[model samples]
Target: MTKRIRKAVFPVAGLGTRFLPATKSIPKEMLTIVDRPVLQHVVEEAREAGIEHFIFVTGRNKAVIEDHFDIAYELEETLQKRGKLKEYQALTEQLPPAGATSFTRQQAPLGLGHAVWCARELVGDEPFAVLLPDMVTMPAPAQRDRCLAQCIEAYATHGGNIIAVEETPWEEAHQYGIVSVGKDFGRSFEITGMVEKPPKGTAPSNLMISGRYILGPEIFRILEKGEKGAGGEIQLTDGMKTLSKHQPFHGVRFDGKTFDCGSKLGFLAANVAFALTNPEIAAPFKAELQKIFGTL
Candidate 1:
């Protein structure tokens, strides 16, 4: 039997150079989507998917991300005293139970593969999930599966590595790590190969690897080689490609929309998309948007 996937590693060490000077002091993961931080949204997804241990690979100036998960006794007390019971409950509801969360430093911005390697000791020897907090996935109204949960479900059947993939326009496929599959399996397919940012029009397929993955401990061994690819950094795609040679790799087309919060346009779109989903604000926000669009 495959070992249960109880732990998840979150890579949150990026400098967020794209969103400066706001990120000059604040970690990009802390940027708000709707009313909650991007990192919080991903964590909640993992929690809903039954993840028990939340491991964050962090860097300098990322203490805020860690603190966000920790309990705030003073703030909670103040809320209680002010008769803000509902707000207080919501605040406490977000806190991970003690000892469930762990933080490890990346020390340098080597790349995503290195960040995952940093969490090796914490992850031990088992299949675990990796979530890039920069990517926030929201399920469509009729869809019930969260992106990570969908990958986990695929992992159970395939028993190897599961990558959350989505289709990108063929014209823009070169901007991401694209996967080539061998066998069509409906929602998922057997991943035969992965090319990171292949030359324009040279990609094998348009299914880009989104920011979520469920990988086995064997991946750590390949990442340990420290091979650099694409951007002269330790690329996780490179490691996954090497692992695919020995393990069964599959890509699951998740049932949701993914917002690349690392980009300016994607971030703004995510704010509008998520805001439109809020019951309390959706109606008024839609009206406001309609008004703004009418003027244009």
Candidate 2:
């Protein structure tokens, strides 16, 4: 029987250098999309996917990220006293059941593989999920397929390792970790090979690894070798490649859109996209956007 995937590791230690002065003090994960923090949105996605344990690999000056998931007692009490029941419920609603969240420090800006390795002790020995908080996937309006949820569903059938993949323009494939696909399985396909930022036009396929993954526990052993690739930092792609030799590697083409929130343009775009979905603001926000565009 396949082991259940109950835990998820989120790597949130990056210094957000791309966002500049705003990120100088704020951790990038805490940056807001519309009203909720980026990390919060990612957590909500994980929760929707039935991830029971949330493990965050954090770094220096990321206390606020931890606090965001914690109980804000004083704030909750104030809201209640002010007859703001809805506001109070909103504060408590997002909290994970106590003891479900764990935080570990990455301690260095080495790379993604290292950050994930930092969470191994917490993850123990089991198949687990990894979500790159930088990528926020929006579900289709009708299907409403959350990215990680789709990966988890595929994992249930294929049961080895699954990486969420999405097609990118062939011209821009070199900017991401591209995968060479094999045998088609309809909703999913075999991942024959992976390359981190293949040379322009030399990419094996236009399918790029979107930021969601369901990895077997054996991956920790491969990552433990600390082999560096691409950027000289330990690369998870290298580890996944090695693991693929021993385990089945497959890709699930996520049925949705993904926003890379680490970049300023992606961040700004995410705010607009999420704001347009916000029930309280979507109508006015659309009108406001039209009003602004009308002048131009």
Report backbone clashes per prediction: 0, 0
Which stretches of model 1 miss by more than 4 angstroms?
none
TM-score of each: 0.99, 0.98
What does candidate 1's lDDT look like per residue over 1-296, in tens digits? 77789999999999999999999999999999988899999999999899999999999999999889988889999999999998998888888888999999999999999999999999999999999999999987898878999998888888899999999999999999999988999999999999999999899999999999999899999998988988899999999999888899999998889999999998999999999999989999999999999999
- Candidate 1, residue 4: the lDDT equals 87
The model with the greatest lDDT is 1
lDDT of 2 by residue, 1-296 (tens): 78888999999999999988999999999999988899889999999999999999999999998899999889998999999998888888899999999999999887899889999999998999999999998987876769999998899999999999998999999899999889999979999999999999799999999999999888888888888888889899989999988899999998888899999888889999999989999999999999999999
State, as a TM-score between 0 and 1, how close model 1 is to the true structure: 0.99
lDDT score, candidate 2 = 0.92
